[model samples]
Target: MVSDLAAAIWMYTVGPWLDHSSKFTRTGTLGGHHLLLLIIALTGFLMLAALAVLTDNFTHSTPMLAIARNVACVISVIALTGLLALILMALLSRLLFGPLRP
Candidate 1:
């Protein structure tokens, strides 16, 4: 629930800010934004990996643990999907609008 909320907040807030900022900036390249998305994806992957390791280490599983695992997986997928959409949007924008110029 918390993760979902956080993702929603990020998408609604930071995502638009990036979009707006990209428009004003003269940088022709979106390398920095791409790098940011990559970093976000990496962080999500690391979190999911850590959860998996923790789940494996535990012999007995509880109901809460199962719920937590499911939530974590869902959040990770959401994050990746959002990032993919952003990347695709960026690529399409570049193709349609051409590169930003000074």
Candidate 2:
């Protein structure tokens, strides 16, 4: 979860700068690239929150704790799946479009 948050922070902060530095033109005000980064960051935040809740409930052995853990697990899985999809998409794009040159 921490890692996810870190990655999200990096994407939200550094990713755009990296793109700009590469000399790629900005697609639009709210292009697919920007939207994708937002989605990834949102997912990462959700996963981090879920994990925090799960850990906070770890000391208890109540039904709510069980529920929290389950919910966290689901959120974490979803976040991981989204991240994996993005990675695969990146790989496919690289293969199809070839490497970005600047």
lDDT of 1 by residue, 1-102 (tens): 344345545544565465456553212113325345444545555665666677684455678777766666665665556545556777888999998895
Error of 1 at 21 (Å): 4.1
CA lDDT scores, all candidates in order: 0.54, 0.55
Task: Please list all clashing residue pairs in model 2, or write none if there are none.
Answer: none
Which of the numbered candidates is closest to the native, going by highest lDDT?
2
Alpha carbon lDDT of residue 40, candidate 2? 58
Consecutive 10-residue window with the lowest summed lDDT within model 1: 23-32
**Worst ten-residue run, lDDT, model 2?**
23-32
Top-TM-score structure, candidate number: 2
For residues 3-102, what per-residue lDDT tens digits would candidate 2 score against the true structure? 5565466557655754465333232212325446556556756754655676673554467656755765565454445446556767888999997995
